[model samples]
Target: MKIQHFTNQLHLLKEDESTTRKGAFIVLSAICLVGCLTFVSLAVDIGYINLVKTRMQNAVDAAALAAAQEITNAVNTAPVGTADVTQYSRDQARIAAKDVASLNDVFIDKQIDVIFGRRSFNESTQEFDVTWNASPSNVVKVIARRDNNDTSAQDGKLKLFFAGVTGDRYSTIVAQAVAYVESRDIVVVHDFSRSMNFDSYFNNESSARLSDSQIEQNLELVWNDLQMPNTGSLAFTPQYLTTTKSDYGVSATVTFKYDDLEVTSAGEIEKVQVKYTDNSYQTFNGLSGNSVNINGSKNIETAWVTARGPSENEPVTVTNNGISVTYAANRKSATMSSPQRIRELYVGFTDNSTDYRSYGSNGPYNASYSSWKEMDYMYLEVLDGRSYWYYFNAPNGGNEVTLQFDDSNWEVKQAFGLTGSYPYPRGSWDGFINHARNYSEFSSRGFRETYGGLTLMNYILRDYPGHWETPDLWKTRHFPFHAIKEGHLLLCDFLEDLGFDDHLGMVSYDTSHRQEKTMYDSDPNVPSVNISSEPITDNYQAIRDLMQYKQAAHYSYATNMGGGLEDGIQMILDNSRAGARRTILLMTDGNTNTMDSGASSSLPHGWDWDELFDYDGDGNSDYYTNSSQRRYVLRTAYDAVQNGITVHTMSVGIDADRNLMRAIAHLAGGHFIDVPGGASVADMESEVEQAFHRIASFVPPAKLMNQD
Candidate 1:
């Protein structure tokens, strides 16, 4: 009985131990299960976070790029203050960032943390440096936040799926991006040859000439506001010598040994300026024996002065040659007719501004001025195979007019003929009138503009942003040059708006090449090409004026495309800034039919016309013909490529040497933007603009930069 009892106790103890083991195992299993689920949740949350991070990065990058583009557009549109530009850039950048962020769940925590700034290379550190709020705002920065740190940011929280369900959620992500704008320099080579006239625009089936009345009416369509200058200014058109400009190579040789030399005598007024109380002035030259004819241009005020011949008191002279000019006499008084009210008068030489008007708001100082010789003739006469002009005084009888010279009580009044110098030329100027009638037929294509109107200054006054002349008007006008002028002017406006760093230049080609001059003639009839080799300039207004008033050359009419390209290359080499991207835009409306005499030497060794026609054993093919004239043009393009210049080609009508242009573009690493060939004026202008805009397109809007 004792043995059996002991065995029972042992069995009980073993069973109890087994039960304890089973309980411990169950607890361990539970712990292991919990750990495995926790790990799985963490893994899911991490993957989601990474995915959100990637999305955030892409959003920020896109936002930065949009903002950067906005800055460039804002700058290229209108003239605004610097503060406005900065604010606009920032605003646009922020708006863009928010827009993109909304789609990508990337939001800004603070406005200051996001924006554009100057991103430039740091020479000292050999790395790019970022300056916040710096001008030029070439760089844009964007931020994406989802850390749930800032409530104002409204950053979207990430869903961790299974992880969130298990309360092991971790939703946070932040992304940043920086992007930058590019810089460049461009030159234009325009084929101003006569053949460009034959483009489809001018190659219309009808050759009917429109009447003057029709032209005036049509000209009126291009402008909205135009007020004529005071025509009652002077008694005579001052005739003088207009110094013609020579090519750059020649101009450089004729260096000015001296100009402002110390006058051995009391120094005649070689040139005198009148600082008018108002924004106006007059000018006079060639001072000999106390006599000089003077004329003035009207500005905001209306003041007329007319002196025919020498009188007892010839208005201005070197009386004392004192520190300032003083009128020898007091004020000169004048009586006016209705609507012919006197605004201001300037005695260009007599420095003492004290000589002013009376009973006219105490004209403490009316003004002082110097005379300028303006090309004011209606017709250009070629005498002895050279352009010449003859000036004669033929004052017409009219209502007695009083010219002014007033001071204190002494009103220096002189009676001069105030005849007709408006609407129509009225007077005893029979010589000029006869010459004008001689060319009244205006058959020459060169007389297209002058066939009717006086000047183009009245037409560019329109607020035309997208409107150019219609095809119907263009076809009826039969004016191809006019079409080009209209289109080129638009390009001028486009270039004018380009950032400050860009420089502009124009080269025209006919039988020769010319770096155009700034023309201010009412008729622009004189020789208008000179000042060769002018480096590209930022003065867009000056360039526009040159294109506006400069007339077609009657001397030579061949298209010397090679000359245009050579000079255009020179302009770039002489002026472009260091480290700036270089480009050449060649615009031609016809095939190249002419080249320079040195065409063979100008080309590369293997690229010369060819040895195919070498009668002599010499390497070069003897003579080049008109057929291969385009090859030389193509060769010049190759030269441009060797110099690292990007060459773009443009053509308007079917006559454009498209194949040659295409070849040139291919060889020189550029695009051949074919402006459709035809009478579509609006399309032509639009094409010209697009061509230039395309050149501008090379500048990337914004690109992502590595972040730290």
Candidate 2:
């Protein structure tokens, strides 16, 4: 029994040992499997995280770049409130990111934030920033921030991979970029019109109806005056008198006259004498008559008597039926002349009617009233050592007119005339000098008051005496006063006065729009004025075709003026060559259409009076030809370009096409602006100042250093 028990125990021990070894092997296999799976998961997750991080980084970068680019384009194209460039930029970023993701076989999710800083005048020192966010699944999150700290600064950040494992994870990436706002050398062309002047009547008080202080500060009144009537007499003369004969023989007439006639005189003259003729042959010797009566007889020949006065030089002879007699001349005869002759000798006076009186000697006339009160008419004469005239009137019923004088008593008129005037001097001398000083001091000062150091340019029309008398006179005599002659000389002598000779060259003439003529119609002395390369039977039809071609040609070849295809080409070329960074501004009425046809691509319709020769039907047809307009544009452009000039063009009250203006701006790499309506003389001056400011900001100070 003992031996069997010992053997069983040994068998049990062997079985126990086998079980233990099997359990140990299973435990080791389970441990190895868990370890291997954990390693594999880590590797895959880390790789994906890195890939996501790179994609997010790229997305952020792209988004930022796109936004920046859009900003630049917006500066060139759209107005402030109307710029929708952000949306387009975001779309571009998404497209780029999507493409990249598709190539990488990874899903990407992105969010962009475009933040715009307040656009202040001092953009350089001010902070302007934009931030963009990019997030991708299992990848990184990137945040890109850009600020106008140092535009040239390169600053960016990137964060890779998520921290949490298994369930959820999060990561962050940061980046920054800095780009400078490109400084542009700009020239702004602006238009001035009646609309700019608040639709005031031309050459009327309404034209310059602003207050004195307002005028003084806001406007550089170039001129103002009365618009005189086309028909009126400056002086008057009397008609000549002659004698006549009658059937009665020697009739004598009585005459009454005064030695002196006064304007205030209301007294009447008394009759002196009368005479008659009869055939009875009766003579009355001593008849000093005060009043006279006439007598007649039947079958009687009449004879007239002659009065006698004192005869110092010669004796008077009276003839009746061939009888002659002499009498002494008297004082009454010496003083007396024929009363009818004396009455007929009166000369007509000036029409000093209440409604028609001159405003200023050279200004627009005030014809608002019908009848003249003594005070209503302006006087060329002075009274009591003062130049006085009516200053105000009641348009309603009051016949009374307020008188103004240039004496101490007339001080009130100055107050009445100069009310609500603008306040400020034109501008700093440095500022004006910086802008080439081509503008008037008054204009500069007015602009400074209204717009604070802004630059502007004014283009006034030249109308000979009318201009000199009206707006010009008003300007000189009133607000921002300047002499008309001096102003004219300043404009005419721009080259010598403003030192623009280096940049602005003489214009060249090329390309005639004239058409070929037939042998029978051709005249060497008088070339064909029509714009045609070849003659056609239908004159109108040929002209139409040529016009279309000319417009097309202008679009293709003459679209640009002073600049190249790139930006600031004109400024760069001109500034470098001329050693001065000055802008050229042109003010015109836009009435010239120099194309083959009297039409423009830029305007709604293209027929301008300045370009047409035969606008009126008066049979006279000498006027500007179609070629003149084109020639002007082309010549201006070519000269400006060749001389390295930045040309800015403005149209005032002209019917020019908008497209043409835009084209001109684009060609010159400049700005095209429309002046606002109801703009006072002050407003126009301010606008010019604004333009100058824009130009100054564009060109670097270094470029202006060499200019004297």
Question: Evaluated with TM-score, which candidate comes out highest?
Answer: 1
Cα lDDT tens digits, model 2, 1-708, are 999999999999999999999999999999998777667666766686566556655555454344434433332344457444444434444444444433543333444333322111222543322221321000112244333243343222222233243443433334332222222222222221222232221223323454434433332332222222221111111011111111111223221111111111001112211222221333334434322332322211222323222223332222221111222121011111111111111111233332332333333211121222222111122121233321211111211111111111122112222122212222222332223222333332332111111121111211111221122222222211111112222322322221111122111111212112221212243223342232221133322222211111111112222112112233234333212344544433233323333432232134343433233556543332234454445344544555555555543322334444444554455566543313354454454344433432232221101111
Q: Candidate 1: deviation at residue 679, Å?
A: 6.2
What tens digits encode model 1's per-residue C-alpha lDDT throughout 30-78? 9998888888877877777887788888888888877777666765542
Instruction: Return the TM-score for each candidate structure.
Output: 0.45, 0.28
Model 1 residue 497 lDDT score: 46
Q: What is the C-alpha RMSD of each candidate to the true structure, in Å?
A: 21.9, 25.2
The top-ranked prediction according to lDDT is 1
- Tell me the lDDT of candidate 2: 0.30
Error of 1 at 555 (Å): 9.2
Displacement of residue 457 (Cα, Å) in model 2 is: 21
What do the candidate models score in CA lDDT, each in turn?
0.48, 0.30
RMSD of 1: 21.9
